[model samples]
Target: MSALSTFANRDELIVGAFAQDLSEVAERGRATLDEEVAATAHPYSITPSSLSHS
Candidate 1:
């Protein structure tokens, strides 16, 4: 018997909980990517000289 099965007679709850957690993480990741895309300038845009540290 699996650990979850031992704790809960039904395995569905374990699966459902995991799926919900994964969905939340994916949504946050997508939001972060969207913000990055919006902040970046066009092809000719240049970064400020002082900001370049490399």
Candidate 2:
């Protein structure tokens, strides 16, 4: 039995809490990426960009 399964049959609750935490982390990561993309001028910066060959 998993650690969560031992918690008085609250496995679903435990999983849901973890899922919510992960969702918040992902949202923050996306926001930070947006800020970085907006602040830099380097053509090949860490942010993603469409391909170009000129």
Candidate 3:
């Protein structure tokens, strides 16, 4: 997650919403990583609006 700071593009940063716990987050990450444009950073604390309702 911290490694994302090396890039100049904050636009590259995306919040993958999940439960407060990391279980859902990890699952989401694995799924997305199979794509070409995968997430480069995982924020430590996502904003309230960024949280998943599902």
Model 1: per-residue Cα lDDT over 1-54, one tens digit each: 988767785667788999999999999999999889768857666658647987
Question: Candidate 3 local accuracy as lDDT?
Answer: 0.57
Model 3 C-alpha lDDT per residue in residues 1-54, reported as the tens digit of each score: 575675634544432222344777787887878653435545565757679696
RMSD of candidate 2 to the true fold? 5.5
Deviation of model 1 at 36, angstroms: 0.7
lDDT of 2: 0.80
TM-score against truth, every candidate: 0.57, 0.59, 0.27
Q: Which window of ten consecutive residues has the lowest lDDT sum in model 1?
A: 41-50
Error of 3 at 35 (Å): 1.8
Better of 1 and 2 by lDDT: 1
The local distance difference test score of each candidate is 0.82, 0.80, 0.57
**Mind giving the per-residue lDDT tens digits that candidate 2 earns over 1-54?**
988667857877888999999999999999999898778757665533354544
Q: Give all candidate RMSDs, comma-separated.
A: 6.0, 5.5, 19.2
- How many clashing residue pairs are found in candidate 2? 0
Candidate 3: give the clashing pairs: none
Clash pairs for candidate 1: none
Q: After superposition, how far is residue 51 of candidate 2 from its true place, in Å?
A: 15
Candidate 1 Cα outliers beyond 4 Å, as residue runs: 1-9, 43-54
